[model samples]
Target chain A: MEGGVYLNLPKVAVLTMEGTNNEEEAFQSWRGAGANAEIIHIKKLENKIRKLEEFDAIFFPGGFSAGDYVRAGAIMASRLRATVMRDIENFVDAGKLIMGSCNGFQVLIELGLIPNIGGDYEREAALATNLSNRFEARTVYLKITNNTCPFLRKFRINQIIRLPIAHFEGRFIPANEDLLEEISNNNMIGLKYVDPYGKEVGYPWNPNGSVLNIAGVCSKSGNVLGLMPHPERVFNKYTQSDWPRGNEEDYGQLFFKGAVDYLNEKF
Target chain B: MKINIIVTLKDNVEDAEGQSVLKALHLLGYDEVSNVRTGKVYYIEMKGNDLSKGYEFCDKLLANPVINKCKVERDD
Candidate 1:
């Protein structure tokens, strides 16, 4: 039946665990974009009830997964690395489009999946506590630095979009300048914190004092994207903090939509 | 044996927590203190005297070599 094509949408797993409260919105965003998405507990993957290869893509939603006590995204990444590191590594290597938001971004960095300079899971960076020394929750303007990344294809290069970021450890600093140079040279820097006017700014404008004002990044392959922003919360304009200010377009949904669209077109 | 591990950001990395603490100390009239840095301490209890295992944990899980360094002290 030709109508069966609609029933064969790509499956996206919005992985979750106790304290990870953002899976619902992430799942909705994926499903809203025509993917069959689900809120899957990390245990399901760990216990092998569900398999990573079953899904076309996997998303790590924002939340204090594992209470974020030791470090943001530390425990969850450690657990996953211990159990399913090979599967996840292969998933990224296979270009299955993995994405993470906010705390999930921290997990990616902890897992050494982003800016994976040498194709090895060597953690070359750390998302330390914000320079302001507090959890910041605000809408920030991000300049899309690289459109070649599948996640940022909907956005034009240098396009500035508004997204809300909420986190304490949002500062993205790599281990050394060499690695930073490598990421920049590879165009792995996907999003940069900028003012609404699109000027690279500092403090309140930058929001997290990230090095070079980086807000999001992709791997060298650009299939995996990690950003410290709550794109899921703004699936619609009404969810945006500035909705009353004549906000109309939903920029956040475009990201997930782009990923889904890429998956559909590719596989 | 009990092993105590102290983990802290490398000296070059900016310690925002330490700066905030310094600010508080200045407000408290203790102006002589020149520097402050925040770090973590973890105590691991084990039965073997294999010192290399402690360093191994430090290299792998206990400390992020990218931005942190860890020191292990043995307490028998």
Candidate 2:
């Protein structure tokens, strides 16, 4: 495992729904990072849920599913609730990794996948329209909240990474002040808006007016993560906005790297 | 029971959609528009004798705190 370049990389499954448009890119990104990956459409999972067991990790990529009607992620969440909830619970209960990006994050929250403590149906965070009230497509800086979550194991505290966010509703709202404080104190806040220079700025630094400038959050167990930033969109240097001149390496690579490393250590 | 649910952004929270509407209204010569915020209205028919359970549904499942607030009314 130490000597091989692709040694012990895990097999990742990129889950797709009727309207998910980013599955291929996510698959490519994870594969490029040395993980064996493939896209698994929701339709395929409708009849059977055990297919999820074949992979070490699962990902829900970003896209405008079901025309984003009712809400950006409402339809997808409903579908998951109707079908894959049990499979997801079993996977997470097994300590397997699960990730949702952008619209995918919305689905996870809608399906009650993350932020639930002990109950079968618990509400997690919600992603609504941005504070700007318009679809914003731009590269925003994010401060990685220092935590022991497998998702952020390789990231440093206050590290600024540029990621593109394109959505009408990306604002993250948690349920209560106590839950908010718990998430903050536990370092479950995965990302927060920051200045271009990598400093944590408040409000406006919060590109979406999300509470506490939060860009993303995870469950207390850290096995589930939901975020708005498109790490798959920035896996390569060329896709990075400041590629040539910036000293920063492609931060999106860490998403795959961290998961693979965690899985490798498990077996 | 039939209930009406009104969901709106909290006071401190910004309303992007409502702001756009206000801007549009101002452009249409409604210059007196000082502030504008948008909200959702839902008419739901629930089957239950207890109103608390209905409100619980709205509080726990329907409304999200980080972005919106919800109010419930008995249609009758």
Candidate 3:
């Protein structure tokens, strides 16, 4: 406030509710990156106790929210649409950051927030059940496709990163062919599955049989991102599935750090 | 009022579960089964006879248009 630079710290909200078990790790990741982060329950927002506008950035962490019944991420998204749809729309239009990972990624698609190529907030894609016909839980390699998204700002384009993903519904498919083209032309794709050697692969390597090997995507504005992986599970080399080999660097921390840094500079 | 809703994957979308189910049926000597697909059905009893409102609810929350198509009918 003294030198025209805001002295107040940026606040990031890691939203959660019953059945959302990943909020703790996601909260720690944000706080570890020098942001004032909190785990806020959806009830707090719905009951008017907390407003979504209060936070500079918002994260929908991975979990089986609402028991993941009906469909993964359906119940929670429906509840939000029934009440705070306008608030979310405005938040996105204002260029605030929003990220959803794993089951949270499913929620983002259900909420019509990610890959909103037309800016209509229409549900144009789905995270369908995997072709494997079972839950997939393991570490996989992902190549960053576009770094324009705030969440991927830390990674170079086409850089391969290893992260763990645990989900039954992780296959990303667009509603139609035209929408797929729009996503590509708009540069909304954020990550694509690849082998450790950086070759485009399928099946066990791709893990989910997603279209174009897409692992994650963002909104046209690049503020909203959704991915079916758990970066929080690998904040350090010790936590990674197979680590201490490469650079032993904590690759997962870069994502949360990028978000915090972006918010700090923009706000 | 009673309503029955059926939700199915779009025609172009691959039904991996349905295909697997069909494969199992074939192994069980059910060669008569030419094809198989999976879907969800919801039977609800509402307070009014507003069919349009029922459809709206289905469109908004009951099914995702991305990979699903829904059919709503009166449960007569």
True contacts kept of 1: 0.52
Instruction: For candidate 1, report its TM-score.
Output: 0.96
lDDT of 2 by residue, A1-267 (tens): 253655456878898877887898899888876787878877778777438888889999999888786567777777776777788889888888989898988888787776674347566567878877767788888988865778778888878788888877888777768877877777688888889877666545666778888887777788888888899998886788768887777788888788878887884
lDDT string for model 3 (A1-267, tens) is 243332376788898977887888888888787778889988888888999898888899998999997789998999888888888898888788898999899999999887777678788899998988779999999899999888899999989889999999999999879999999999989998899888888899989899999999988889898999898878776899768667756777988888888888898
Error of 1 at A251 (Å): 0.8
In candidate 3 chain A, what residue range of length 10 has the lowest lDDT sum?
Answer: A1-10
lDDT of 2 at A75: 74
Model 3 residue A8 lDDT score? 70
Alpha-carbon runs more than 4 Å astray in model 3: A1-7
Model 1 agreement with the true structure over B1-76: per-residue lDDT tens digits: 8998889999988999999999999999999989999999888899889877887877666676778888889977
lDDT of 2 at A235: 83
Kindly report which residue stretches of model 2 are placed more than 4 angstroms away from their true locations once superposed: A1-9, A117-121, A202-204, B1-13, B32-35, B39-76
**lDDT for each of the candidates?**
0.89, 0.79, 0.87
Q: How much lDDT does candidate 1 score? A: 0.89
User: What is the clash count of model 3?
Assistant: 0
For model 3, state the Cα shift of residue A100 in Å: 0.2
By TM-score, the candidates rank as 1, 3, 2
